[model samples]
Target: MAQQTASPDDSNGPESLYILGPFMFLGIVFFIVRIYTRLALSYKLNVSDYTNAVAVLAATITFGLFITAIVHGFGHHSFYITPEDSVIIFKCLYVVLTVGLFAAVFARISLACLCLQFTTSTVPKIILRAQIIFQIASLIATAVVTWIQCRPISAFWEAVPGGECFSPPQSWAFTATGIASDLVCAVIPILVISKLSRSLVERCLVCFLMAMSLFATAAGVLKIIYSYRFDRDPSDALRDMMPLFLWCRMEEVLLIIACEAPFLKSSIERVLRRMGLPVFQQKTKDLNSIHTFPDPRGSQGEAVKKDKGMKIDERKLEACEYTTSEDSTQSDESDGNSTRQQHGEVTDSSQSQPMSTPMDDV
Candidate 1:
């Protein structure tokens, strides 16, 4: 086969680094800052944080593999690369696709875990858990399909007599499922935000941040669309499929960023408060809206009755920055109970104790 000359419009691979480099940098920076805030500010980590960490790890590895692929003629015309470089590029791309899906799934998992903290409702929990299970199973199947997409496996990277490859739909099944998962993760938080009694500013802020996951979904859609272009020319696959990889990276990195943004917002609020700045506090209309769970002892009504003129605790309100109030709830309950008792209205001690909700302390 005579090597075909590339056209003027063909990409030579190096230019991709400029776009992907800054994306990877921002993602790693956000991941580090989130970890620091969790440890130094909250002094704790939860399931969500740990899951987000896994996402960051997988994404970082995928980014590294992407750079390797670029060096191996990823963005160039197929005939422009030597046989050895082509093989290397194919192998690197295979790993990138497989590992990039893992990053997307884990990022969605992290966001769902965080949203779960805001609601004890059984329906949303079931929905989120179901989504997680579906994503994991679909990705596992996708990985298996990717491994066997081309017969003998080695045929995936190197040409062999009688080698065969699966159709595109088989390879794209997980991507469709992934888009669904992203939408589910983003929309669930909006439902939670609607029921929250926070001010319009706070509600809008939370809604906006949570909805940012849709950008990843949009990228996934574009990835699928560009993938169809692969059928345009088999000999020009390296150049033709470049958009697929670009959109794939964009989808993964966007999910990681969107998942972490809400937590980072809370951390920033804490920092601003510490510096004595007038930060936007989570304001509630009444005691009923502050806690998600109902009082086990029916003390909520009693507390409200005793403190009709509720004194908004700046300390408690300030600390309840995120969707859940794990830190400030106990203190607020204590303050309410003491004031009630100080009014000389004696009640049964056993049944009148305040409720304590156990949540992922943001």
Candidate 2:
């Protein structure tokens, strides 16, 4: 097989790097925000948090793989690359892109885990589980079929191992499943948050968190739209796929940030405040909101009096979901108190209904 390193004159090489670099940077920033907020504010770690961490690890590996591919002559027109380099690029691309797809899968799992915190009924749980199972199955199927898409499996990167294969249709199937998975994951959270019993302001806060998924879904949609450009030019597969890989990496970044957004809202708000933004500081729970004073007559002539306000217990505020006071709630599970989290705001739930712990594996 022929072999050649990419030249400085190869515009495609630079273009591909530029496309992925920004997203890779933004994704790193979001990942940091998530880790800090969960540890500093929540003071507890959950399964979803661990999954996001793994996604970051996978992203880092994929980035290194991309660098290797570039060094091996990817991003050049087929004519500019040696047969040997083509084979190297093909092998690296197989692993790197596959890792990227699976990284996105873990990110999606993190989102689902966070969203699971909000579910109220058995049916929703079952549905969520089913969707997750289906997504995993489809993704695994895509990976396996792709690896074996051509018989004498080594045909993927080595033409010397020539064999007949039906990969185009299988590739399309993979893309379809990916899109379906993203759409379902994005839409379901919206539906769950929409059904919350909170006031419009509170509901909007949660909706905004869920909207991250919608934004990432849009990114995935863009990738699908541009996929045809790459699929149509097999002769220029390496060059054409550069744009596709760009979209793919961006989608990964968006999904990772979206998954982290729910947990990082408080930290972001604090950062804005430190930067001199006009932010509402959560303090002293409104006496009026917690509960109405008992009827005056019920006090048996010990006139029911309303205290203008009570200072917030710092410990409670700290224990509550990422808020400071009026916007937060803290409770002790042993006291049979329930906590309801609406994105960045978690308040002690008035009702003592049970809630499920995060199931990280999904």
My TM-score estimates for the predictions, one after another, are 0.76, 0.70
Q: Write the per-residue lDDT of candidate 1 for residues 1-362, one digit (tens) a residue.
A: 35555354356466666866787788788888778867875798988889898999999998898888887778887767789998898899888878887898889889888878776789999998888777778778877777787788878788889987766565577778888888888888888876664557666777777778898999989988888666733788887777778888988899998877775666666778899977654442333333212332343433433455776454554333332344444554564532132222322233343343221233
Task: Give the candidate number with the greatest TM-score.
Answer: 1
The TM-score measured for candidate 1 stands at 0.76
Worst 10 residues of 2 by lDDT: 287-296
RMSD of each candidate?
10.3, 10.6
- Tens digit of lDDT per residue, candidate 2, span 250-310? 7777778777766555655567789997543222333221321123223222221354644
Backbone collisions counted per model:
0, 4
RMSD to native, candidate 1: 10.3
Clashing pairs in 1: none
Name the candidate that leads on lDDT.
1
How many collisions between residues are there in candidate 2? Answer: 4
Which residue runs does candidate 2 get wrong by more than 4 Å?
Answer: 1-9, 194-205, 231-234, 272-362
